[model samples]
Target chain A: MKKIVLSMVFMAIATLAMAQNATLPQNITIKALDGTSVQTSALQNDGKPMIISFWATWCKPCNRELNTIKEVYEEWQEETGVKLVAISIDDARSANRVKPHVDGNGWEYEVYLDQNQDFKRAMNVVNVPHTFVINGKGEIVWQHTSFVEGSEEELLEVVKKAAAETAE
Target chain B: MKTKQKHLPLLALLLATPFLGNAQGILGGHVTGNIQLDGQISHADSVIGAADVPEKLLMNARADILYTNGNFSAGLRFEAYQNPMLGFNSKYQGQGIANYFAAYNGDKLSVTMGNFYEQFGSGMILRAYEDRYLGVDNSLLGLNVTLRPIEGVTLKALAGKQRYYWEYGNGIVRGIDGEVNFNSIIKSMAESKFRLTMGAGFVSKYEPDQTISYTGNSAFRLKLPLNVGAGAIRADINYGNWSLQAEYAHKGQDPSIMNEFIYREGDALMLNATYSQKGFSANLQAKRVDNMSFKSVRTESGEMLYINYIPAITKQHTYAFLSMYPYATQTTGEMGLQADVMYKIKKETLLGGKYGTDIHLNGAIITGIDTNRIGGDGTLGYTSDWFKTGDLYYADASLEVAKKLSSKLKLTCTYGYQIFNPIVEGHEGNLHHNHILVGDLTWKIDKKNVLRFEAEWMGSDSKYDKNIDDKRCGDWIMGLVEYNFTSAWFVSVSDQYAYRDGVGNYYNISVGYNHGATRLQLGYGKQREGLLCIGGVCRQVPASNGLTFSLTTSF
Candidate 1:
């Protein structure tokens, strides 16, 4: 048991050390379906906490989690002032339908398009419904893959706690 | 909505970022952009819709740029399609900023004016979008609003016209959808071992479809904005290692070009269950749909015209032959089932060998739902309810085994059996028996170099032509060799020989280099026509002989 613990700590330290020196991931530039463009880096919710979610039209889990946030996102923002940028990773094949899919869902989100997967790959995303929360320092504070119905709310709670600590 | 406003203004007040400070203001506007390009050259004699599409050169490209600072942002996309690749909207042969919009984000409220994507309750009633590869873009031109008055509740409202090709959809669409998180509302559900979550939404669209019919007649003559509505509710709960989820949706009737005003009402049901432990896991999924084909313009083909998507619950495969005949979800009349299980032997055990042994099993079946016609020919007909089992469309069962021979060597093998009925997915009548086998061996000679070899064999029981055809049953064998230098550079060579049946033998050679933050790859191959999919959404890529290049980087 002692050896196992020592080896795990060593591995963790080594991996974290290797990952630490790595350059900070650059933010992505995406087009709003409406013809507007936004650089993910330029937006500064960093002082608080920011949630970046990757989603697409054909992905049900993506929609499910987004919809859940749609229900409580406003309240969470008001209380914790947390921000979320819902990034749509729909390729050219489904890009045109993006407008209607968003309109129909009636979701009030800061939506952007990663049409070419530049943003998707930049963040090492291999699956839809991937999410990242950054601190005010522009560092990835937390990240999760896949989503269940209630995961969004759980995510908000974590952000709220992080924001509270920042305030302290 | 709230994310953009609070941080931007706060950042300006705090003067936290030095880069944003410039001439007119301390917070400078941002510059952002993206581009997509697809080009194809082909040759075929005649084309029957898309089934026998002739070969031709085609290319599509689009780029977008946006500048923003403070609480404001705006951008545009430039598009170009010379011949419009296969399955693209025929009208989009031209090019330009097919979509654009502007917006403001705030704490309790937000507003946007321009073109965008929207959906309500699985997007059955209202959906606008684009899929460049499959040649479908249906952006909406309009205004949208998001409102949040309390915790655990959200509401969205929007009105717009669809973007067709370089234009807009021929209809006026407006919708409102809201969802509630039970845990957020109840509070008590928090901190419990058993977690439960639930939500519901409603969506609707209005389109003033052109007053015309198939036989040169005026249908609807209604000359009114076609109205379609839908509602959906979903539930998800998890306890320990087990989780289950389900969603139900329904959409009202609205006629457009695709179904020829075939009053095919829409509805869908999807369910999934999963269980997992230390080294074992199992999952099951089932989905059913009927007459739920909802689109702004019914006449549109390919993936662009879909009002909603039915996710295929089956496990996506990686082996070449096993993935050749991928099953695309049928939104009209289809029922499907899938099951998957995986297990790994504990290390240090006799059966685990030196490292461990891994086993995986997967099975999937898709079939059309039975239905009865309600009207005569050339008339708007109705179909029975969905969920009714009908003729089987396709089925595949597969198993995989992997073992570590020693500390530096490992091998994996897989086999699959498939039953494919073409008629169900709009193909001509014919059932097939497909058998596939795959083997892979990996060897690590030292820390700086590694080598791998792969082999595959596929056989079809009855691919021969019964008529006056000299073509015989087809069989294919493939071999691939890969060499890796350190962790940055790699080269691979592979060839697939269609020894007996098919018209063409394919060869592929690829070289790639990954430098942690960036990767570059180049390849030349004679690609066989097959279904290409990511996630649950899928589309078919045509047979092609060509060279390709790709580059990816992150700063």
Candidate 2:
């Protein structure tokens, strides 16, 4: 009985420390790799369509998925005019590697650093390799966790559907 | 509210546009945002629930607000954790503003003030920040400025008080850092195809420590300097198919509550090299950290108020069993090495017909650093000497292969071997043995609709430590199947079982409908027991019997 009581106390304490939110707050700053400042609003494509991939240098899946997509990114862009933005959540320890990592990988997508994870937390991303698909009007249309070998192909198909609708 | 305000600014900007609404009241600004939610209502179960804590309902939601103008920007977060789920810290049960900050940028001069987050070199000595889901917000509310006096020279200085709990912590903290980026300084170097970037940064902080009590001399109450300093220099050079990077860092005596004894300062080094070409690539990485235990508070919980962030170099798998065991960095002393290689077999070959085949192999190992302690009888040693060798701590090796098989069929197989030590993480000190095999197949039925299947098997050689574990060790198996109907609807069913020795047999079934931007998902599952991590953040998961519902909409 005494052990159960102690465990209950511990459970209460742990649950109380978790902070949850249903929607993102209204204020935050988005900075570019060169440390240049861009209005969060500037990232808007007027709801046409967009893809934001949460990644980190230390995350193997993030590296794998990003490189896999880079191989056919130009084709996706030409087909849908959709811009895929790769956001690096590499904190201070690996933040310095952001530049070289991008250059070495030869990825042509727009890159940003979220060392603080303000954006990641807002998006409720508990892990790297989380991808979000936004429609042309600026709404999160879909989100998928984790990446398999050909998940990029599935993502592109989704983009193609959105593009076909835009043409219609 | 943000979306409502967003249009007015655009409308106003469109009215101002001489050409029309395209640029006018359009108040043209780019907005990128995301939100995630996990909610559950569990039924009372003697084995999973905490008797009185109501095996009832719990939920949490976090959103990031990012607003930026021409040369300046700002962001804030609103979070709520109403009875957060099992195995999570409860202090964040209350709902309110979790984080807020702003910054301004210009040529050679950048200034930021308010509640902000920052990390020093490798976060070895100091890092302040926020993580909404796990309810962690340790931003230092103060002033910060960055000055670039020369083309390649950059300097930064900050002084602030740390945020503890709902308010600020009792301790005051201050720090200054600077770095010179060689690539930025030389325009000619930028023009060269061979990319090279070299830079160095140092950070120092002052936080009074009150726990260092001494008895030898009553008057000599070792007033902790709270003074901690670290320096790091890194270089990246790329020539042809090969690229290399190396970094070295050292920290001076700054005692935080994490490393009890004033034992000694810390030093670390990291190196990475890679080679790539058409259809093939390889990468290698190595790192070592010694005697570096720095924290903000001596008495705080083990993972809280971390002064430095230790980056782990290993692949993080997402499959249920693949992720069952993870390698968390041991900052006090550790040495690690990793290698990864990928090869693609061209089409027309036996394995690759028209699309080709992909094969990959990756391996990593970590060990403890060798050290000899020499110091005072009671107080923390002033200095300790460390050798360049140590014993193996952990290792993970894996091989994977993917084949096209046919136009309509694709298959993938993966095998992994791992060794885990319990001493560093504080659970069980026994060494762990794990072996896993995975296979996946996808059928393109038509194109608009498809079916995917995945099966995995994992076996362990280590038994649970009798001291802490109520149940013994177990072999595990997992399987997943999903069907997609059109572009907006999908359904999946997965099950994980620990039938051999442990007691984690869980089944989950979920279906989601993505109509435009609104997604609704409902799931029923028995959550297994284990540690879960997202974005370098970790939390334990308790076994539970429950139903979960999630609805997310953004415009």
Candidate 3:
């Protein structure tokens, strides 16, 4: 079984050498802060770049990254017309705390709950603080895992680059 | 063995090659996956009870590959635990394709084959999930189907055997669930301020009969039910800024080893209420679990094969001292309540300063349910009153305040108090009372440079006893400093010392580097023995003086 599985993976790698842009998966449903269902396909910024971050209430690094981004979010929005979407993968144990944590931190990003981590698995995110940059066409253009103090600066650079690409 | 180890990295690289370009391929369907490798090398430490390891090194690695088209998706996970790491089950030493599934998720209908994880109504009566850190994965291997015949209405059905290590359990589990959204289903309520959703689920497990002597009496045999069933009902209501969720579950009588072969039935209840606005929020939760340890095989009595899950109501603290004594939910019989409040003082005020102040307070208390023992085996083992209280199990309260000292610096302070009884972990001791304090500071030195410092102190009333070897006793002090540079590299160093009535001093240092979608970290440290828990499920971790490294990448 192990040999077969390994060969299949290698076959896939051989055929997928050429790269093409991939759109976000549709038909996946998540919950807004108000307990309303939201479709993944509806996550749009009106042809502007969007930043989606996967975080949790218990992850300290994730909180740090979000708080840092919140500091310069307004200025970034003004400059690039970008939107930041925060998804909480808190599950049943701490899902209830996401809203309070976000509000208490004064974060203005659009927040949603992935109680079952369905969206996290769909994005193939292995860990928290994973950030993705999407172009105007809803294609994922850039992505990063983990965060340090100045990673937000790099994130903004990608957003600006994506916005520039879409403008042309 | 060396040759096998060398092939692992090559295999992972081959699996990761397709997504290295950050694009989809293979007939227009996206090929995405993640790879994680964790390794440890440790030496024996008698003072901390770290056992000697004959193997010089141990590693745990896994790779997940997923292929997705418009409405169809397929995925598989390969896991390899070469000689399994400490704190992990030795049964997992071998590795293979642990999980695989194919599914079609469309607008109206969905079907999945092979392994799948699911939860029904807050997972009171049914929750099949995986927590890699806790070494708990109960995903079912079977067929699952979902139907949305109308808007706001969902129906689901599933049948399969639970996964046990690399194999499947003997029992078969079948379940059905339905949910309705009133606002969406009823046109008249579409614009109503009140939003409501109700759901119900029924699950049953069938295990073949086995002959067993009653209470070691060879002449007597006990009758066992071939099928045990459990049902749950839940409601989620939201009105403006107020929200409430409640679920209740009941199980039929089925003598099992977890309950000491008792025929008594089981039940659980959970409630949560919350109100929130822009800058403030409050929440309260309450739960009660009684004889609710439902598993696939009655004879199995470990952390595996649980057919249901009961979440703990206590807050999951992030600070070291604040979470020193983590709470693990008692599925047999326990009651608990938790309250939380968060408020932000306005900026430029007397106490708010220029950037405002954030205040958070949380408290929780748990107690055992009152019960009167009747008899063992072949009889109702115990009787309990619904509204009566028993011994106190655990209680804790904490308050944290944070403020931005400047545009480039931030400060946070916290105070916490806790009382813990060792019986919850199958140990006996007087309740330990502790007081903890923490202070944290962060400075953004520049656009690409940052530094953080943390200090914590814990004072406890419990004394260290050589008989029990509980290292968590006595007073402790910890200090840490971390620096990040170049937006990609970070170095952290920390030490924890038991200043009074303790035996060990643990120190650690680590360096990490990150690139796009990839991270690598290497560290050498002395680890303290304790229970590593996530969401009330816990696994015992032994102390070790070790070198550890991890690599993670996703695309």
Candidate 4:
């Protein structure tokens, strides 16, 4: 019991001291919505900032977050060269529903399926609605987990920050 | 014990390296991790059938840390289940570094040593994974290697022993898989309209021989096979809007407790087809399994040590009442089919508003295989007809409609019908029929405030029997209301009441706060006993009245 408490304290301190310098993961392969194999490292936005959102069809918060973002996606993109990439960790059983769900909602984001969750594991994603912002240099600048009613606005703020850094 | 002690310094160093690297402003390397802690305190309640808890407070906590530098990466997970929470196996007590792995990814080759999770060909033959909520962690401890020999060709080989709680299983597992994408392999096919991919895998397990006594003739003993093997082949083809995938797996005859020690060969077949357009989409899936309960240990039973995954072809419901009775995959001998369709009523149509309406329909059915029993021990046990389906095991049909009543409010209504046979759980009884209805409304009051309400009702013909003690058999009603404010805080209250032929009321209230990558939630509730399922894996959760707290953070 003492050792567990000590370890928790140590981890808390270490986490606080850590830096936010995450880079895009490489060499992991996932499937595109069209059923074609695509490498995570190969995803590029033509020197633009990007937002990656991890979601699943069964996750209500994920759907809520994405739908909220869809309402202001165009404005965010127009203001900054920011692109959103939605990744589905649906596995095989529910993987078939992703494309239709996205299309039916008129969401204009690139979608991919991580059936085996290789990319999710690599990114250290513990739960859905986890979002990451990548700058033009491919460095992960910001990330958040879970979503509230207006969390998309905060995401846009981070995207704008990444875009500003790229412009500088 | 001495060797383990000797590694204490190494463990300490691994834990401290990330902080030191960050302090030194290290370049080109990143450290990431997540932590989750769940704690519960409960008291015995006779009315709810909750058993007295010897441990008044139970907790489950885990921390996963990963360090990555270029193509080299490593990770470790520390898990502590201090008198594990209810519903989790009690075997998971104590704390340690449950999983650790180091890997190197090269241009065309990657190798991982230590603990790893993997799957092959839709997981019909092999799948090693972890679901913390389900208390399932089947990661293998050994080595895994993946090689991309040429463009579009990938091969993987692994040798390991499955993790059983804190110890490794008694059997050794080895597997190899290879896949080829014709479109990428052949230059001409790259631009073709059709895309094709094919794969094959072979998995084998080796365990020490064990003596088994026949059921009727207890004096006679039989020695089980030391080695069991399974092979699978799969293919995926796509042409424009149409796509199809299929997999077939066969396993050599082996005696196991799950199948009553039958020597029948195991086989499984799964097929899926899908078509989609801008406004319409449809999916169809069919699967059949015959004596395919492959496991690492012949005598081991339960949710762990599964060597293959039987795909569940039913719609996973999101509504409360719709999910009251979930179907468990019958791995022994079952045939199932599922179909799903989604269509959008375009804007300006009669049924469609300015924002359009979405409609979804799904149906699934599973039946036992037509089989004739033979002698049980030292025999094939049964003969099954490939084209015939026997008794109906389960069926579900559901329809849902979603519309934006206005810019601030969205409404979703669902109707579901289910027929379930108790035989799915190895119990024989009449089929239980249930009809459920749900209405959910979400209103966005403002940018930072949202309110949601949900109500569900389920009418069932099967009454709850005290002898059987299945709480899910009775008619029930549920209601929930949630309010979110300030974009970071939320509260919800819900209740479920069984009003007819059953006596139970479960009420719950929860509050949560989220900031950045951290979330904390607290709840006090009475939980009704039921089967909690994810994918096709089911776990029995006992009734309990408790106060629970959960905290999760990632960096």
Estimate the TM-score of every prediction: 0.69, 0.77, 0.93, 0.93
Candidate lDDT scores, in order, read 0.60, 0.63, 0.82, 0.81
lDDT of 2 by residue, A46-126 (tens): 445688888876565476578668868888887788998888887654564565567545678788877766566556565
Model 1 agreement with the true structure over B1-555: per-residue lDDT tens digits: 001121223222222222234335322344333454556554442211122335355665666544333444444556777756655656677764455566555445656677666544334344555444455556667887776566545577887776666555565666676755455567786555565656566666655555554455555342333677767777666677676667788877655555555655567887767776545767777878776676655456655545455555554565667776667767666888887776777668988866677777889888888877776324446666555788888899989887767756768899999887766556575687889999977676765566778899989865545452212236778888877665356677887776765434567676766543344555566555544322111234545556544443322
Measured against the true two-chain complex, the DockQ scores of the candidates, in the order shown, are: 0.03, 0.08, 0.46, 0.37
DockQ of 3: 0.46
Per-residue lDDT tens digits for candidate 1, residues A1-168, read 433553453343334333432212333335554333345556567488788888886564476567557768889889888888888877432443354455444566777887745466446554456677766565566666555433455577678876887788
- Best by DockQ, which number? 3
- Backbone clashes, each candidate: 64, 63, 0, 0
DockQ of 1: 0.03
Pairwise TM-score winner, candidates 2 and 4: 4
Superposed on all Cα atoms, the candidates' RMSDs to the truth, in angstroms, are 13.7, 9.3, 4.4, 3.7
Give lDDT for model 4: 0.81
Residue-level lDDT of model 4, residues B1-555, one tens digit each, is 101132344555554554464444344566688899988888887656666788798888999887776676778788888878877887788778788887777668889888898889678889988877778898999999999878788899999999988778999999999989999989999998799999999999999986788775778877688899999999888888788889999999878889988899999999988887777888889999999998999889888888788867787776767877778888888999999888889888889978788898999999999999998877899999999999999999999998888888989899999999998887777899999999988888988888888899999998878777776778899998888875578888889999997767889887888777777877788876454221111223445688878788887
Worst 10 residues of 1 chain B by lDDT: B1-10
Model 2: chain A TM-score against the true structure? 0.80
- Clashing residue pairs found in predicted model 3: none
Q: Which ten residues in a row have the lowest lDDT in candidate 1 chain A?
A: A20-29
What residue runs in model 3 are displaced by over 4 Å at the alpha carbon? Answer: A1-14, B1-26, B529-543
If the candidates were sorted by their TM-score against the true structure, best first, what order would they fall in? 3, 4, 2, 1
